[model samples]
Target chain A: MLLEMLQSLPQVLIDGLALGAVYAVVALGYTMVYGILQLINFAHGEIFMTGAFIGTTFFILLMGMGWVSSVPQIFVLILVLIVTACLTGLLGMGIERVAYRPLRNAPRLIPLITAIGISFILQDVIRFIAELSSGNYIVTGPSLFTDQMTISFSSLSSIFNDASFKTSFLIVLVTAFILMISLDYFINRTKWGTAMRAVALDRETASLMSINVNKTISITFFIGSALGGATGVLFAVQYGTIDPFIGFILGMKAFIAAVLGGIGNIRGAMLGGILLGLLEMFASANLTLLTGGIFGAEYKDVFAFSILILVLIFKPEGLLGKPTAEKV
Target chain B: MPILEVNNIETYYGGIQALKGISVYVNKGEIVTLIGSNGAGKSTTLKSISGLAKVKTGSILFKGKETMNKPVHETCLLGMAHVPEGRKIFSTLTVKENLLMGAFSVNNKQLIEERMEIVFGHFPILKKRLEQKGGTMSGGEQQMLAIGRALMMEPELLMLDEPSMGLAPIIVEQIFDIIKKLNQNGITILLVEQNAYQALNIAHRGYVIRNGEIVLSGKGSELIENIEIRDAYLA
Candidate 1:
């Protein structure tokens, strides 16, 4: 069974990379918020869900207007993604100002509880909006990419199934990589990025340097949530369906990825996200064979969390996080 | 006109009063040092002028403008720079990045470059360690980087809190030499220091603070020779 799994590893790896790309994008939101404010931002998942819905709504509206057929497919997709990300970024900034800003000096637990509360509020609000519009909880995204969009790998088709490589997956992976690279550059090179890092390291000192701490934090939220929103658009396109409930599981898995990669570290989040996605795909694909039919794809989620628990116990600072010395 | 004027400012941290109606002022092109023991409200006084500490009842006039109600960054934009206590340099950032952040309010690239050149001239070691992280550097280097960062704003008034803290005597002497040169080059300075002798040596005027109040004020030479200052602070 192990040998058979090794033979199919390439296919599993490809699947994992596509899924991992999405998680890395989403995990960025969690990691950034935690880095500056030390808040979990549990509402981030709902923000992702809202982005998916926003993208779906725009696509459906465009299709209804018959613009999708006339416009280039790539243009429409990019338009949808940009609009969704901007709207979600605004929503994230609004949430920070209204909910988290007031509680900045409150105890850690207070803001955490507020974050969880915000999460539920966002889910219910999205659900209400959906029910009001279509009288249904689940929304089906428009099929943006048809068979013509598929990029076939004819040479590799003999080794792995044709289904393993798809144009949508390639688009998602490439877009995610571009976003990550840009984010890395923005955080490391830009003045605002330096301000963000300074604020995260020492708020008082950052202020003394004349950095507008509040503005820096608001921009951080904007960028982080925008990344999550972009990921949501890609997820909706890849899956062709989204609901308010979808954020719960996906968000939790992304959170696990963030924690696994060392929650406050940016590069760690990317590495952790891809590793978690690969682990999930491999476990679902090979576990039943290895265990002689005792475990199957149904236990894949459980396997992911079990690994999270094991990692937390053994390396709580995470795979890439340095153990920080607590200041007196 | 005095560059910075603080009048009877009372600042509190929660319920505890840190500054009790303390007043100090700095004139243009002068080094004014505030010497005090630990917890003597020296830092609090500096914070109040920079808008970091709330003034319950007082007025801080900077260049003839009421600055008590301004935000920290606003005061900074008005040509006031504070190199805070503990040398609060951004440890995770590179030395160059830390200096760049000091120029946060300035948008002119040429002016920033000019300021960078001036900073490098003052502390040539910082120019060599531009890519090094602030935290990994030696204490004296970090202190220089902190001062270099404050200079990036090209401020008219520079407020330093304990710039000589935790440095070797030779390094502290080097830092004091830079402070004197900066004042000579026409930047007003408000210095807070535990090393009263070194501070007063370079300062044109001085204030001796104790337990949130100013106990003595005079010329630097006079304060240096005062029996009270010699026994309480110098000794």
Candidate 2:
């Protein structure tokens, strides 16, 4: 049984890392927005979903225009990522301006509820647009990098089965890492990033330092939503089929990853995302063996949520979260 | 002409008026202090000038620019830096980062470093602990950090709200000395304080505010000697 588990480990880890990469980038959006606003932006998931739909639509349009054949697929992916990021960034900013800004001083619950309302609106709007344009809500774009690849290490393949993955996995992983590293640098090293930290700490004081608080918040929304959207594009490329509902489940998972890592800390979100992904994959691969066949891979979400409950019970602040004092 | 001129400004919080027709002015190279007890709109007046507190009516002129209703950040661009009540230090940030935040309006790194040198001159302890977190420092050090942060802007008019609040007497003296030295170096100061005696001692001119109105204005020394002033504040 142990040998059997080991046989599957290589595949699980590879798949886990790719999924974790997706979760980590999406979780960043959740963590960053939560850190600054102290409001859980439920619309974020829909933003991710919207990105997937937009990316697939763009791919179809590009192919229709015969642009895909002329340019490198990687450049097309990059273009889609940029365009989708900007569109979703603007969407996130508009949500903040139209929905959250007026209710800034309102009770905290109002914004949370509004976020949910916005997500519902986005989901329905995407569904409506998809139905109108394509006569179906499910979208699958032209395969760019679906070539299968094998990994062989003479020393390692002897102990474990050789891992195999699609080229799209590499694309997703590379794009996510680049985005993550850039975001980390932007948050910690850049003036605007440090300024965001200041605004998170104290908005009034940040403004006194000549940092425009409203603009900073708007930028935060922009960056967060942009990352989510780009990750969504990467997600579509990795897994062929997508729908408006995909963001909801994937977003929930990423959010869980954020919580697991420590919601407000940037690096924590990354760690949490990758960790959650690997854990989910591990559970899915071995749940039957671990549970004497009582539970199977289908119960992966149950396993994932159980960990969240356990984490909440044992370490409420999460793996890297600083225990903030209770505030009224 | 005075570097800063506040003409009968009215400011409100919620539905209540905090400053009602309060006027104050600071000439170039003078230490001007606003002394008042708690809830006397001292902070609000400074807030009004710095664009932190909304002024419902009246005009604030900073270096000949009418800036009563400008954005808080634009006020900083107008060469006005306000160190708000309670030191308002970004305690989680390092002292260097805190000072860097002060230089937010200035883009040139060399100019920022030059301004930082001036700040270091004012507070050597700050330069020594450049990497230390602002909150981990003592109250006096945090206050110094706050002032040093504001000085990064190299403002023409520096407004401080309660710099002396919640500090040991000796630390308070050190802060007041810095204020005086800053004034001597041609930075006009607008000081708001609950510690009327200390404020008056270093002030070239003083305004005594009561219930959001400036009830008395005179030379600091003269106000310090007035009988009614002594009875209401000094005593």
Candidate 3:
């Protein structure tokens, strides 16, 4: 039994890691924008959803245009996804420039409410498109990725014949790792990164240093939105479906991951995401099994939210975040 | 020509006036001082020049341009640097990053590198603490870093606001000496202080402010010798 459990640990860890990578990517959208603006882009998850929709639409359009036969489909999918990310990222920038920029000096709540409004607006926009195209509240799109690739480490030939959960897990792991490393480099090793850190540390001081504060803020939104966009596409591939409303819960969870890791710290978000994913997995695995099937699988969300609330009350700064004291 | 000219500027914090129509000037290569008690708006004047606070009714010309309403970055670009009171160093950044931030307006890497060398030469302490975080430094060291940061900008006029606010007398003397040396090196200065005696000793001109208005303005030596001003402000 002990040997069986030990072997299952890696499998559990791998599954948790895959889930965590997605959360980290989504959490970055929140953490990056928050670091610079000190505002939570509540609409970030929707931006992620928009990315998925954009990728899905491109895949459908490519298949419709009969372009799939001329080129490798995955290559075309990658290009389309990038273009979609750029578009969504630009949209996020526009939202910052128009809605949040005017209220830059206003009380924080006003912008937060505006963010919620933008979230709803994007949700409606996606729903409207879904409805207009299909005349239905639900959106149905062609799948860009199929779960054909699998890796199995099984002694039994029957088990080996069954497709393992490697493809979805691998895509999540690889995409997340590449995106995070590149982002870390972009933030640390570039002039724009220095300006970003300066703005995050102190906006007034950055402006005092003759750095264009407005441009820095806009670029932050742009990058954050792009990350969200990429997450959207990846999420669709992982889940095998896309929905306009998927962002609502996922955005909230990513936000929870951000808070768990240390909201302003970049690496913390990644850490938080993976931990949250594992916590959910363990809770679902043991707790649902222990209650003799009455507790059910849906309570997993409740467990995750309960953890968030408890963490907030006990350590408001999150796990790795330092508690900042106001300077007199 | 004066590198900076502040003329009849009124600044207020929600109806209670902080600076009541204050006018001052620092000609090229001169050390001018604004000395006053707490709440007399000595810091306010420096803040106004640096675009930290709004000027309700006045004109501030930096290098022949009306810079009253320009934002902080715009003013910094026009060759004006401010070392604000309380040593507002970017605490999380390294000493090197702090110095580099001062040169944000200048994209020319060669000039920035030259200016950074000059800044490090003046404050060798900063060179040693280049990789250390700004907040971890001693109060005196932070003050030196603040001055070094301003110098990195290579401003025509450098404004120091209460560099002696919190420090040991020995550190204070060292800082004042550095101020004199910096002025000797041809950077115009507008020094603000409540320590009237030490400020006037190094200053070419001094303005004595009381209750947000200038009560006395004269040559630094003459102000130091005035019986009423000396007894009221200086020991």
lDDT of each residue in A1-328, candidate 2, tens digit only: 8887888888889999999999999999999999998988989999999989888888888878865689988888888899999999999999999999998879999999999999999999999999998899988888889889988632476767878999999999999999999999998888899899898888888999999989999999999999999998999998889998998999998998889889888998899889888889989999999999999999988998898889878999888898875221
Q: How well docked is model 1, in DockQ terms?
A: 0.67
Candidate 2 matches the true fold with a TM-score of 0.96
lDDT of 2: 0.89
Write candidate 1's Cα lDDT for A47-74 as tens digits: 9999999989988898888656798878
Q: What DockQ, between 0 and 1, does each candidate earn?
A: 0.67, 0.55, 0.59
Candidates 1 and 2 compared: the better one by DockQ is 1
Q: Model 2 - which docking category?
A: medium
For candidate 1, write residues B132-229 as lDDT tens digits. 88888888898899999999988899999999898999999999999999999999999999999889999999999988999999999999999899
Instruction: Kindly report the docking quality category of candidate 1.
Output: medium
| Structural similarity to truth (TM-score) of each candidate | 0.96, 0.96, 0.92
- TM-score, prediction 1: 0.96
lDDT of 1 at B192: 95
Ranking by DockQ: 1, 3, 2
| Clash count for each candidate, listed in order shown | 0, 0, 0
**Top candidate when judged by DockQ against the true structure:** 1
Local lDDT at A305 for model 3 = 76
Candidate 1 wrong stretches, greater than 4 Å: A146-163, A326-328, B230-235
Cα deviation at A18, candidate 1, in Å, is: 1.3
